[model samples]
Target: MTALRRLVATALLITAMAMGGTAVAWAHAVRVSADPAPDATLATAPTRITATFNERLQGDFAAMTVVGPDGNLWSDGTPQVQGATVSVGVRPLGPAGSYTVNYRVTSADGHVVSGSWAFTMTVAGSGSPGPSATASTPSADRALPVWPFIVGAVAVIALGVIWSRLRRT
Candidate 1:
């Protein structure tokens, strides 16, 4: 009975350690807030679009774009990263329709996080649209989670330990 209890305790500890490691490894930056907000309707066009993440962002390859209703890029200049926030200037929006803000940023853990949100412009603007979206748009491919593989390895180890102990009995 004591041996069985010890085996169980060891297995639990190992499982906990594996889960903890994976939790840290999987800590990707998540968008906590955005300027203009998602699905927001505004009377005036914003000068810039900003995205705030839950974790600090990396400086490299941080790209943001505001695509206007006409399928042209409204985002002007390069994207700036300040801590957990990433933003880009808008080149005066055109047309009174939906504008999508697409962002592809690198998280603190060197993981790539990308997403897009749209806001409606109730009023039209005088500023001309930027270049076409086809000319320049960063790819926002999401990385796959590795927690499942970690969990599987933990289960296998626990099962092997239990089986070995039982065979010894």
Candidate 2:
């Protein structure tokens, strides 16, 4: 009985360690906050858009764009990353309509994180529309290999079968 209990405890410990490692390996950077915020209604137009992430970002890999309601690009200049925050300048907004902000940034861990949000302007501006631009979609992260987990589970089952046979004998 003591031997059986020890075997079970050891199996549980190994399973826990494997699961913890897998969780860490799958972790990705997340968006913490944004300047105009998601679905916010602003009284006036914002000259810039800023997004904050939970992890440090690669400056060269960071990109953001502001799309006006008329299907025009309003984001001006390249995005700048300072630590975990990324900001991009925007041309004066035109008309009172929803503006979409799209962003993609490479996390410090090399994972790409991308998302889009929109804010509505209550008052219109005198700014003219610019060229059309496409927003980048979030690239899917690489999935962890499944063979190891399957093998580990099979081994655990085999161990249990062996233990059961020993007990019967």
Task: Compare the candidates by TM-score and give the number of the best one.
Answer: 1
What's every prediction's RMSD, in angstroms? 5.3, 6.3
* 42-126 per-residue lDDT for model 1 (tens digits): 9999998999999999999888999888999999999999999999998877899999999999999898899899999999999
- List, residue by residue over 1-169, the lDDT tens digit for candidate 2: 9999999999999999998888655667788999999999998888889999887888876778888888888888889999899999989899788998988887877777888899999899999877875433223343357799999999999999999999999
Q: Pick the candidate with the highest lDDT.
A: 1
In candidate 1, how many Å is residue 131 off? 1.0
Candidate 1 — which residues are off by over 4 angstroms?
1-17, 140-169
TM-score of 1: 0.73
In candidate 1, residue 9 scores what lDDT? 100
TM-score of candidate 2 relative to the true fold: 0.67
lDDT of each: 0.91, 0.84
How does candidate 1 score on lDDT?
0.91
TM-score for each model: 0.73, 0.67
Candidate 1 root-mean-square deviation in Å: 5.3
